[model samples]
Target: MMIHTEPGIIKRDGVYFCSSDSFTQDNLFYILWGAVYSLDSPYRVSRSYMDAFMLQYIVSGELNFVLRGKTFTAKANEAVLLNCREKNLYWADRQAVVKWFHFNGKNTLPLLNYIYERNGGTGLFKKNYTKKIEPYIDSILNEIHKKDSNVFSISHNIYSILCELSAPPAVLESPAEKTIREALSFIQSNYSKSISVNDIAAHVSLSTYYFTRLFSKYMHLSPHTYLLSTRLEAAKKILIYTFEDIETISLRTGFQSSSHFIRAFKKANNITPNNFRKVFYQKSID
Candidate 1:
């Protein structure tokens, strides 16, 4: 989508970057545009139609967003993802600093659908995940400042930011459920490292036997199976989205060896990793 601000709006101080045509043509996931604005006076923007999805985070003050004729207020540490095709208006309730990213690609719609389903069809919500999102925003801004920013790096950071947003809301977990959830979070964050079921159990301060039973009951899979599945899932995403070779992919996904990765991948997917990658690229090309 073209990037243009409405005329006759109050002036604000901001830094922004728009993706180049070459970058947009080659990347499946990309930020079409982004901006960080610090308003000295009141600011407002109205749009009848925006061609890409937008994620806006409030940094210091509050924003009043009107979408579908409903008004919602987002304050510091909160965010909203607007379906840009809809009519919307957002204005600062007072002087505020805000950061926003406009993103689109093949994966965007499906990811948005998943988020909407989990969020009860609402576009505004509190940021319940950890506080690492701000650093990611800084990283994106730094990358954009480079004379030749790597598209992959910026895109990957954007994906990380979205993943943080799309995480399920914080729930009050029972003691057992909390322990299991901690273990699962560890597995997800460290799957690429050389970690074992014993290590996972130890991190959660549980005996191997007890941990195995609890995990199975809660997750419907043994801890070992869960770790393996996590690794395999990471491998699959890398294979489909990146050009890393089989050996590199194996190492990155925590497999002991390329041959072992191949065997496990074939057993799980009913096709070799190479074949899976080929099929994915072929579909993208078609």
Candidate 2:
């Protein structure tokens, strides 16, 4: 089954960069395109404290890029990938236009590395991989252009690129940490059920007593409290998006009853479900 998903976005050839026009696309995938331009000299911008990763495929002119205290120049057709939460400075020189994407959500790091490795870790222009990578970049543009583009495809493509860029495993190590991560992943996947520490411990093949200690050591919360937090988080999502009654939301989020759910929600958020919804919705509309 195809999972419909929203694409994270950056615009290429958008109003910010356009001399006389704008470009837009409508894919289930989110591809936002925008540009910055100047005629007399180079236009430069500096970004700090961002949430996602950015990769630019320069379409025209020259770009001076700074990453991790190092600077480099990228001419037309060359690309650069910035890892998440990194601060970088870049400027364009002499009539420059760039096609860029700001991508996030799951596997972004791997994708960035994959693109870098494929381009020989030096310059995107020297590696003859644009023909190979263009399809993935174009996928973003095409999805934005389409009336019904599947965002899942774009997400999958990004994940695929990440997988390619990641280094292969060296040796098996840190079994305890791996076990804990697996246990937490299981909890995240099964939070909507009546779950317990024993269930999760068994899934990870550990004694409940030992799992409890180890989990608290690593995660700073018992499995039971963790499950409660996860359920409360799910309920918060429902409360924000749906007008479903309290009982329905409680059941859907795996609480035994509305009263139980309400207590948990109030404890976590310091507000009743209805009040939380009303205040948030009111603020959103305003």
- Best TM-score among the predictions, by candidate number: 1
Worst 10 residues of 2 by lDDT: 16-25
Best lDDT among the predictions, by candidate number: 1
lDDT of candidate 1 vs native? 0.80
Q: Tens digits of per-residue lDDT for model 1 on 1-286?
A: 3334443234443446656566464565676667777753356687888778887878877888887567888888877888788888887657677777777776777888787777766677786642657777777776766668777777787788778778777787799998998999999998898999999999999999999999999999899999999999999999999999999999999999999999999999899999999999999999
Off by over 4 Å in 2: 1-173
Candidate 2 per-residue lDDT, tens place, 51-170, comes to 666667666666787776678888776666676366677765555566566556644555566655654453234224343455676666555445565667766655554443343323
Off by over 4 Å in 1: 1-13, 22-26, 173-286
Each prediction's TM-score against the native?
0.54, 0.42
Candidate 2 displacement at residue 38 in angstroms = 58
The lDDT of each candidate is 0.80, 0.65
